[model samples]
Target: MESQVTNNANALRLFFTDDVFVVEDKSVQIVLPAVTEAVSATVSIPKVEAKEAVVVVENTVIPAEKPLPPSESYAQKGEILPIVEEPLQPKAFKFLGGNKKSVLILVNDAAYDVSTEQGRELLRKIVKAVDLATPDFALLNYANYKGTTYAELHQFFKPQIMLSFGVEASHLQLNLNWAGEIIVHETTRIIFAPNLHPLDSDLSAKKSLWGNLQKIK
Candidate 1:
């Protein structure tokens, strides 16, 4: 009789005989009796670590409301605004009279006040002496005269002749278009004293004065 045994990491085989017994490695060949038995070894497997879990969250926000704009106001009734007017300035008058041209004689001096009635009379006498029918004359005295009154005199009689007698350094202003035959007599001739008109016939005398004044160049 014969016997044999074999062992492996996972399994083992064994046999028995009357005469002899033998032992061999797992991969080696072995002869065994018909009553042999095989045994399988149990194996243990390790568990793997669980995978990590993931979480998802969703959030939403809403904004606050804003205020609206205010409405416009209505205008009030019965409000009156004042009108503005500009002040008037003085202006010289131009010549408008035809062949019957007028004359203006001015004696600009500090020694005489032509604005006064006495001074005007003296100047009228002097102008009359130039000719018995000498043109109408007016003397503007700036020394004693106001600017408003002088402007008024310019407005009243638009003369054609302007004479500055005994004038020092002051300038006599007259309308250039209306004034003609400007004469400057510095002498104290007072020849005009005899040419005085009747106090009652001032208008007729003025007419005669303008007629004679037209004869001047």
Candidate 2:
């Protein structure tokens, strides 16, 4: 109803101008909305065709990053690069007897300081098993010999036979010419033996070492 009243008010505004006086005899003139002439011109739109497309992505191979090897520049003139010899491998346990000789026993570890009574006792058992006129026993803990090469070991100890105990059995084989368990590298004979942790208790380990020791000696 309000919308109809508003529409009628707007219609009356078109009939009576703002200049007309509020009187019963007042005149009203009707004014119609003017329409402009229609504008006509040419508009051209281009046609586009939709089509399918194939996209192929080739796999690129990326090479692994490698560490660069250490490089040294050449010597200029008189100066010389001091020759690098096998580093001195310290004895974990000192030589039982002074000189490096015939039978070098490579022990896995020691019960105590190898110089002690317990160490000597451990040695006495193995030394007794071998049959030799003098025996001239020498002992080295394998832990001491890790850094030393077999070649340097051969040169230093210069043993006729190398008896390795525990994990050192396979370790002593490094840098040495060998067939299997038994290794005959020039003069030195290497015999790999089972671990002797509970040395005195395990009779079989002692017997195994003693048995193989007999073959080489």
Candidate 3:
């Protein structure tokens, strides 16, 4: 019986051979041997847990477009034309030889030519005659002949009634006629004649001749 007890003690020493042993309460205890050096040991472990998954959602908005006007479309077509008007003609007057009663004499003595001197003198005489015969006559010298300087002699004169000799009647006729109370003379007529008819009466329908001769006188 003592031998069996020794055998049991040896078996227990083998089973608890390590320096530490685990107990039923999950705690550990270290054992030291009496006749040998003590041994040590350390143990490590990890814990794990279960989890669930998740999802997410969202929403958004957009804007609408607008239409253009009809007039803007027509403007882009490019087919319309603009209207224009004709210019009116200037009124004509007797610029040279006419009735002494309504005559306007313009003497151009500015000409350097010697031949024009006699013409200038003759113009002076005609101007004097017109002034004496009709108080309504207008006499302008070379200094006063403004507007068209290089225009035709008649255009330069612009007379209501022109009493002239030689080139004067010819120049007057170039731009005007006997229509507007004109009495042209190639040669000086000693006897003067007056038109009994009123000056506003349409003597010629060729040109647009209107306006009262009373205004001119």
What are the clashing pairs of model 2? none
Best by TM-score: 2
CA lDDT of each candidate? 0.41, 0.62, 0.37
Top-lDDT candidate index: 2
Supply candidate 1's per-residue lDDT for 70: 58
- Could you tell me every candidate's TM-score relative to the true structure? 0.25, 0.45, 0.24
Report the lDDT tens digits of candidate 3 across residue range 1-217. 4464445776889778878765586455656666765555555555555445555555555555565554554435676755565543343433324334544444433343211544445434434533444344544433233342213333433444543222233333333344434334432121111211221232442122222222223
What stretches of model 1 exceed 4 Å from their correct place?
1-101, 111-125, 132-135, 146-156, 167-217
lDDT digits (tens) for residues 26-138 of candidate 1: 89767676875676666667878797886665565666666666554353456555667754455543321231334444443355343346555755564556552433334
Q: What does candidate 3 score in Cα RMSD to the true structure? A: 17.7
Q: lDDT of candidate 3 vs native?
A: 0.37
State the weakest 10-residue window (summed lDDT) of model 1.
187-196
